[model samples]
Target: MTTPRPVDCWLTDMDGVLVHEETAIPGAAEFIAALRESGRRFLVMTNNSIYTPRDLSARLAASGIDVPEDAIWTSAMATAQFLDDQRPGGSAYVVGEAGLTTALYEVGYTMSERDPDYVVLGETRTYSFEAITKAIRLIEGGARFIATNPDVSGPSQQGTLPATGSVAALITAATGRKPYYVGKPNPLMMRSALNRIDAHSETTVMVGDRMDTDVVSGLEAGLRTILVLTGSTSRARVENFPYRPTRVVESVADIVPLVTEFAPVTGPEY
Candidate 1:
């Protein structure tokens, strides 16, 4: 019920906030367009590592929401950036799909099947026992472990499908090594996104559907959090959570009114 202060930037979650599975959420496109016209910076931040920013943008446009390639951030990009800074020149044993592999490769990291310096896990629909076994061996052999995101499952047309967390868990169980998470709910990802906007934590708003990741991460980062009920999170779930968002709305459509209420407009200048 508390009002959120005006923020300079909005970091959004894609899967449930903007679109549900393959369909775009109602009024999502128009809301984004309005925000754009108002000069309020916004970006799509997703834990899904199966697609690159460009791919995500294309998918969004196809789903009826027009977003630029640079306006999207994926766990894959964050993971690659982390690796680039933390483990430069180190070989990675990848068990992810094209997006993850592409990001790692773009960052000058070599992907290998054997004797890797790190084991990177992400969502891969083409997962195989061979891939899992190789990753386990590498981790057991003292390779550093990292997962793109900790999402247990992703929304799919058929329902929720297994995500990178499931694979990361299996690898951890087999190798007894915990992977460093590099996605939402993790401060590292928020920090990276904030850096991109050249904005401070206090001036940023993390808006999304999930409380465990998006809202918690924003709160931890000292950013305002907004919970939209267009995704996996329910109103009852938010009530049960220890922390609360700055504002709770039915969907992104409610954001405009909330923004106007929190920060009233004045007469326009020529």
Candidate 2:
């Protein structure tokens, strides 16, 4: 077997690995502190395209996670980066919150309903039927479709709420155009995050909670993956997936010591 490089960079999911809802998981703050003290390049990543990095930073701070705005990577930002590379100075008919719009604007993208280059869909609190209808019409008129993530639903105090993927499906049913998702489960999200931190996948580790989204994406992106049990997928259920993460721990707390214990993972690669 080839000798693996030392893990010098880290990419982690925000919601499950660090904070669960409004509370910070145990050792999450220390985990960040350890990464910072170790001088490791890292990013706190999320698929929620509703809030910008600054907004997310404040939220994480409130939850006691203290991640910087620039250190956070969101689906909105990845989507913007993707569109900017695909078609610079493009136009879009967006159906998301300020996060998506702001990212697009920062990338020199214009928003319009009149024959826009793309119909970009993202996460929002209140998805407007009127807005979705307009997006469908624009798509039918030859606009490409793009979405932030593939999560069909999100969590809330009230209960499960329909998210971007659900709405994107609605538009697909109407316009026969499936959107290209830019968030978790798509290796592009990992690649974009890697590029944002100027980190190489060979020497980076991706820590997340879900087997499907986090593990699979990191595996495909050529990074070692660590699965935590404090989220959606349980250890017992991990074997259900055809692919696997490099390591599995009870939570981020268990990963604190590994900040300085970098080594190549010898797990079989998919």
Best by TM-score: 2
TM-scores for all predictions = 0.92, 0.97
Clashing pairs in 1: none
Candidate 2 residues lying further than 4 Å off, grouped into runs, are 263-270
- Clashes within 3 Å, all models in order: 0, 0
Q: Compared with the true structure, what per-residue lDDT tens digits does model 1 show for residues 1-270?
A: 344345678788887888976789987887778667777777889888888888888889999898898788888999999999987977898888888999999989998876888888988778899989988888888889999999887766677688888888888888888999999889889999888778787667788899999989988898878888988789878778888887788888877664544452121110
Evaluate residue 147 in candidate 1 and report its C-alpha lDDT on the 0 to 100 scale: 94
Off by over 4 Å in 1: 1-5, 258-270
lDDT of model 1, residue 5:
44
- Kindly list the per-residue Cα lDDT of model 2 for residues 135-173, writing each as its tens digit: 998898999999999999988878999999899989999
lDDT, candidate 1, equals: 0.83
As a whole number from 0 to 100, the lDDT of residue 136 in candidate 1 is: 88
Residue 19 of model 1 has an lDDT of 91
